[model samples]
Target: MKEFEEPTLSADAVLAGLSLAGRVRYAAVGLAGLTVALLVGALWATEPSLPLRTHVAFGGIVAAGLGWAGFAGWTLTRRVPLFARDRVIAGVLALTFSGATAVGLVLVAATRGGTTAVLTASATGLVLVTAALALLVTGRRRRAELLRRKAALTGR
Candidate 1:
């Protein structure tokens, strides 16, 4: 019986894996987030009688959204070859942000006696955290696989 063999991948093919469509999607998401954060920040700043907690909430949203937009922009502009490391970094950021948001939502729900809106937001947060975790695991696996392929190609 013949043994199974992995297909060879060229460096160009590897580099081309990041499609233009994907880059455009990332840019769109980053721009949208930046726009939303700026708008919300402006409104938040102008609200003179807002509660302290509301201010904090708005600030958190703005910070998190900006962070996401900045990361996306950085990912799109970097010239150095990441060799799948970017995916890992993105996954980590996503997980951290989503996990924090989830915990905050849960706390808010607790403090507010679990109102429907708060509970719904908490559920959404949990879903995001779950998705982030999946991303992290997938990224790690992809990085490992790429490294292994690199080692094989280089006879290391």
Candidate 2:
């Protein structure tokens, strides 16, 4: 009688299987990395705190950037042509998301008041903006991809 064991895969080979779990894991890692960077920046950023206008501006930028990231990731992974014009959009989206998170950290740090209000508000805003933009971008990318694929199949 003999016992056999499955061979282990190399790190690179294992990584090649960017399945749903892997993708999600990578995305999470990306988000976490961005958050840490932003926190550091906020800790170091100077001044009596950012104005409301700055918050709004940064928020908007974040939304746009996250939206783009979602869209680009969706398009590329799904092999969609909707946003095939440029890969820069994806990079921009990533940058914006990181910037927004960092600015939020600065705002939180600058708040003279306790973190109760700031933490709750920032958490809510972050979730809403991130989810909204990401979903919107993904939805649009999927729709566009479907349409393109359908057209190609039907010779439309």
Candidate 3:
């Protein structure tokens, strides 16, 4: 039986894979997230009568939205040269956001006596954190592989 091998990509092929349209989409998403976060933060700041729980929820939303925007901005600015590095950064951002979200959800659930809705949300948050962790590990491995390939190609 023959073993299947992964196809090796050249630097040109990697660059060619990056699409202008994709970058534009990322920019749009980033802008939208930033705008939403700003609006929410403004509303939260202005509302003096909001309960502590409401404030905490609003803060979490703003933080997560800002994180998403930051990742998107990084992706848009980095271009093709740092695609692997960008992935690693994205993974880190995702992990941070998801882990925070998971912790927050767990706290909320604990405070609320573990209501079904809160528990479900907590579970979802945990799933997201797990996925983010997977992304981080995969990104690191891919970056290592790319570096090794580059070193070999350059006879370093």
Top-lDDT structure, candidate number: 1
lDDT of 2 at 23: 58
29-63 per-residue lDDT for model 3 (tens digits): 79977998999999998997999888888998898
State the lDDT of candidate 1 residue by residue for 1-156, as single tens digits.
Answer: 999999996653565445688688779878977987999899998996998878888888898779879877887887655577778987998898788788778777777765786778788898999999999999999988887877676688
Model 1 stretches with alpha carbons more than 4 Å out: 1-17, 114-124
Candidate closer to the true structure by TM-score (higher is better), 2 or 3: 3
| Residue 9 in model 3: lDDT | 79
In model 3, what lDDT does residue 15 have?
47
| C-alpha lDDT of all candidate models, in order | 0.81, 0.54, 0.80
Query: Which segments of candidate 2 are over 4 A away from where they belong?
Result: 1-102, 105-110, 140-144, 147-156
lDDT of 1: 0.81
Which residue pairs in candidate 3 collide? Answer: none
lDDT of 2 by residue, 1-156 (tens): 778989985333432334576457547645654565455445435433777766565556445544644553554365323332333444445446655665665576557546776776567667656765665576567556755755665578
Which of candidates 2 and 3 is the stronger one according to lDDT? 3
